[model samples]
Target: MQTRVLKYFLTVAELNNITQAAERLHITQPTLSRQIMELEKELGVKLFDREKRQMHLNKAGVLFQQRAMTMITVLDQTKNELLAVNDQLSGTINIGMVESAVSDFMMRAVQKFQEKYPDVRFNIFDGDGDTLRERLDQGLCDLVALIQPIEAAKYNYFPLPVQEKWGLIMRKDDPLAKRKAIMAHDLYQLPLVVGRRNIVRDDITDTLKIDLNKLDWRVIINLPENAKQLVLSGKYYHFGIYGVYQKYHDERLAFVPFSPTKTTGHLLAWRKNVQLTPAVEKFIQFVADQTTHKKI
Candidate 1:
């Protein structure tokens, strides 16, 4: 299938409206519709569920969307790599990372890298460890920053300087906010928000000796940034690390470290056997060198 057609298909899937997609693509509606029709014929599957003015992606279309995005990412990365092969570094480095304190350190590394190689650009993608690592494995991401308990068997990584101290973020006016540290029992029967990752949830439960299923799980989120509204709602406490509150500057929220201390740190990971582009190689080396001075 032609990459251009894939773009058209994805555009339609995104807007879920043919007219809007055609307008956005600066193409006539008939042309765009015909292209999509031919694409579905070639694939031998209906990509969308048509209902009135809305066109929702069917199961096949949902899978194809991921594949299409991967193809585009690969094509872009390949073009950048080929253009920058001879060296003075003028390609975009795709970096995937989780949303946490690690970002604070990662940006510092990026700023310094940009200073030295001004022509180089970066595309930063954020997700949890599983999603970031999947992109890293698919060659969409040059490197991914993640928390501890990474897949040591499949990838090589370097520990970042930022440490993740377990904690809870709550409304500043809450009674528990008065405590410097929160004990496990403090959260008993309380409305709380926590991450949905199994590994992380297990670790938290095991460390705190609290049953997640027993407590009131008010909300479940994929990343720390999403918990802001829930915590600010004045009815919930976000179960996460110190990084949660650090990233948010709302004076109404407070983050308290867990008593007895459970901590983890971040790692910069890349695929084991793949050959990295010159730009990504230099960027990883820069992160390794920059992260060394800070005490781990």
Candidate 2:
């Protein structure tokens, strides 16, 4: 149950190769293997399924991985809190964010906060809404920025003033690129790509009153760059928010808004009832004040 051993176990679980994990951990392969073996013995259960040159998690290992992640996150936060106890203005603030136009405002707040508290440091993690929420629930991050339609009961949040419009990113030469806005029927039968999140697809169906199953979902993209590449190939249109395309516009691509103006708001959230470190609290307040005064 040592923290070091739990880290080793998690590293192995992630990499799935003993040699790779050992190299990353800066430990000998024999030592890493012995530690994992001792950990299994202590827990009284086998954790991995061994195959040639591969180690996959068993049922017990999967369960342990969840608990171990929570433990490690809590321990890291506790350590930061203890270290910052003597210095009220300086500590680590971990934040998770989804991409949005509000990022500039968030960064502005962070810059101002650090100017006042020079010793405070920030760690930023980026992901989709679900991944960000998982990190927050596990106590790995102090705050998260997410798109709207989140479960409001789960966390305290502040809505930012930015509205992200949903649109189509297509090749400049495409016929739809000449139009000011696109409609649901405009995309019908067209090969399209979108974010991998099920919620997004569901929302599109509900908003546009179009059957997603009827449309050709050519690709489900997990990365923005991949989505852009697919659209740039001139065969597909990328369904994404306006900010994303505007942030990284390609000469060959054009972003057209939705006809009905589909939009989602941005929100910053933190776990309800979790004790906040001074640095985290102060940073949140700074964001709040900035949002109140600035028109982002």
TM-score of each: 0.90, 0.85
**Candidate 1: deviation at residue 61, Å?**
2.4
Candidate 1's C-alpha runs over 4 A off are 50-55, 211-214, 294-296
Looking at model 1, residue 176 earns an lDDT score of 88
Question: How does model 1 fare in lDDT?
Answer: 0.87
Candidate 2 off by > 4 Å: 10-33, 49-66, 196-214
lDDT of 2 by residue, 1-296 (tens): 79999999999999999999999999999999999999999999999999987999999999999999889878877888777776557879999887767676677778888888898888888777888888899888899988887877989999877788898998999989999999888888999887777776678668878766678888886657757777888988888888788766678889999878889888989999988998888888888877898733
Tens digits of per-residue lDDT for model 1 on 161-213? 88899888899999989999999888888888887776866876788888656
CA lDDT of every candidate: 0.87, 0.85
**Which candidate ranks first by lDDT, i.e. highest?**
1
**C-alpha lDDT of residue 13 in model 2:** 99
> TM-score of model 1 relative to the true fold?
0.90
For model 1, the run of ten residues with the poorest summed lDDT:
287-296
